[model samples]
Target: MPSIKAALSKPFAKLIAKRIKKWASQPLETQEKVFQNLIKKARKTAFGRDHNFDSIRTYDDFRKNVPIRDYEALRPYVDRVVNGEEDVLWTGKPIYFAKTSGTTSGAKYIPITKESMPTHVNAARNAILMYIYETGNIKFVDGKMIFLQGSPILEEKNGIKLGRLSGIVAHYVPKYLQKNRMPSLETNCIEDWETKVSAIVEETIKEDMTVISGIPSWVQMYFEKLIDKSGKKVGEIFKNFNLFIFGGVNYEPYRAKFENLIGRKVDSIELYPASEGFFAFQDKQDEKGMLLQLNSGIFYEFIEAEHFFEENPERITINDVKVGVNYVMIISTTAGLWAYNIGDTVEFTSLRPYRVIVSGRIKHFISAFGEHVIGKEVEQALREAIANTDITVNEFTVAPQINPSEGLPYHEWFIEFDIEPKDESKLIQKLEASLQKQNSYYFDLIEGKVLKPLVVTKIKKDGFQTYMKSIGKLGGQNKIPRLSNDRKIADTLYKLELTK
Candidate 1:
């Protein structure tokens, strides 16, 4: 028998499904209205006044008046706001700060005010609810749905509460659905990820867990632990398990490994949520890409990634973007992030429906030899290389070997395999061939002897986990960076292996 909450969820989900469908049909106009509304709402804020928001009547005006800026450029104002200043970026002091990693800098604390909470919370909720509506898979709602979240014990910086975005979100799970949430509150408050995962396995193994949600890598770790403890496959331990909700990293490389871990096929949904806001989600079952959120209090712009590296890049708004171009994303959001470069690059797959594939990070790429290799390209090559083979990559990272002392320059791959491919050497050959097919500059470099083919190094079992633990980054929201232009991380991995 379904609970009252489960019965009502279907109708509410249906409403959201209808709203999103209509929203997708007229994305450009919806985006324009969103931009205008955000501007009006923020016009009195310090940043808005400083940028002359009153003069910004249209998207063109917003673009012409405000230049796109990365985090560093806005740090001064953010710092001021952190020190109890009001209206520095947004209208008032933020209720909380979402702490996240910074690639080059140290940790970053992003302000999350009352005004912006819904953009992160309700928007993501609506995405999941709509998925349930579209698929008519409400059985999971009747059972338990375990969402792997960060530590709930928030730290305070000055007067503001600080914590992981996931942790903060957990505090707001609706009262009706709270009973179905898993991994006891005590377990959720455990700071260490390893200890927390073990506790979760102990608590959830005997429960009726129907759905699980988290990043693919961490979720895989949980599934492995479940199998190890129960001596049963994940599918057996949780027979009712039917759905996987994931985001943060691309699921392509980990798909086979996840299936093998669970021992069966399961429906999965992808989402695009950053510390800044929830951006997109897999709306339909058969869609190749997630639908962009045009009316979610976010105004978006795109700059061609190649041009972004140049002296001057042309910025294109939602109305002007074309399908199939790699563009770095820029956003002005309810969070008071205006003309901000979110550091993500994406490619549009559909125009009318406004669907996009997150290509990669702006800073995570290999261009040591002028052969620009982005995450999308590397992932595509890996997918092609493993096609028709039983190779299941558990985890992997790539870095450039540019030193002449290393003999020849090449891209080095450290792969942790779940299932080894039939032909190891052939895998390398296919990877090289696929890369050449994707990037002509890389092919030219290989032909000219300027760069050698990529080298693959099989990492020892649990090597990535060991490395991540050593660095104190083995936990929720922490990820192994896929590509680096230098040998910093790769050399560390080698040294770790040597010490072992």
Candidate 2:
């Protein structure tokens, strides 16, 4: 059985290697041309045999005719595909569906066609290779690469096993790295989320790891467990790790504590992957955020953040995007999605089409006490305040609560600390002052008595993890909600209050 598995895995791995090399060596122009061709193919497949190909020759024709779509709009089609409607969207069998947690809704299942699998595999491989190339730290002993991700295997219904995104990746990973990579399948597959976390912690201690990849919040939780079990600091356990790649959400608020936990500054990479598509990844280790893979098998569109749903919304092509302008990302992918809005907001850092930064989620804004605050503004204020004072944060969440007696809302900051400042009050004051200065709107709201003053609530070192576990959402792909966009989240926080 082992020999048969090896025989099948080796050839698949070789094919993946060839594809990665080819993609890396291709010129920018060639990549764009390939993307254009793929787009043409996808249009034909998406519209089906009912549409006339001769009528759609120009890019404008495709863009103008195909309506903009969202996950809710695509659910019916996805359901059809899953129910053995193979001839509709997929040319061949779909090996798995990548399940993703919805921001406001519930779980979403995205189909992974055999044809689309290579796009996911290549994007992921190139993301890692890009980091190594840019950092010039490719030389290291053969060690394990740990990916903290969701379980691929879904519960069996009617004796048929369903597979999620993790499963699809698992199926293809052996094709890319036959021997060196280790999937967190065994740990993630456990039925209970908490049990899975415990198992992962136990297994991580036994491995000689070199690369650790996951969402920042969950990774911090795992590190905390290591600290408790080994009686060694985070730096000691990860001292030999060559790289740490993280993504799924912004890590700015937790950056200082994360770096401190690892003992030394290590190379960090961020990725922008979604259930709909593997959208972008950090091309260089030193860069701030990931660059969009413009030439991949995905068509891109940007909706102006200020006027997202206005009739005839202003759309920018890859060549037209500018630096520092917030836009909601929309994508057309090989998975038969057309003009799909993935609900992510991004800003370009450079004029080059590929370089960009994830600013925040489209609807995730803090408006406690009428002070509208976006992710970038909050991150900037936090960074400035931390620079002023020598305090570090590992995990954090900000909630706006209405003071009933005062008839105003105040900002309550829940932060997990690594290093406590000598003057805690001073640190809190600086953070508040910075917010008032940097975010004038918030400042006016507070000063006008529209909102209450900022209050810092220091949490137990592992408070966020405990909260995540309590909600059955503590793992690699799961993330803590930073700015509670909903009132229910605030209610939950109110219930967990350890401070008066």
* Candidate 1 worst ten-residue window by lDDT: 491-500
For residue 390, model 2's alpha carbon misses the true position, in angstroms, by 3.7
Q: Report clashes for each candidate as comma-separated counts.
A: 0, 3
Per-residue CA lDDT of model 1 for 292-351, tens digit only, reads 988888889999998898877899887888888899999988777888998999999888
Cα lDDT tens digits, model 2, 364-446, are 77865545566776677667778855688776677776654555567777777778778877777877888888677888987
Per-model CA lDDT versus the true structure: 0.87, 0.67
TM-score for candidate 2: 0.84
Listed per candidate, the RMSD to the true structure in angstroms reads 1.5, 4.9
Evaluated at residue 169, the lDDT of candidate 1 is: 90
Instruction: Please give the lDDT score at residue 1 for candidate 1.
Output: 78
| lDDT, model 2, position 30 | 40
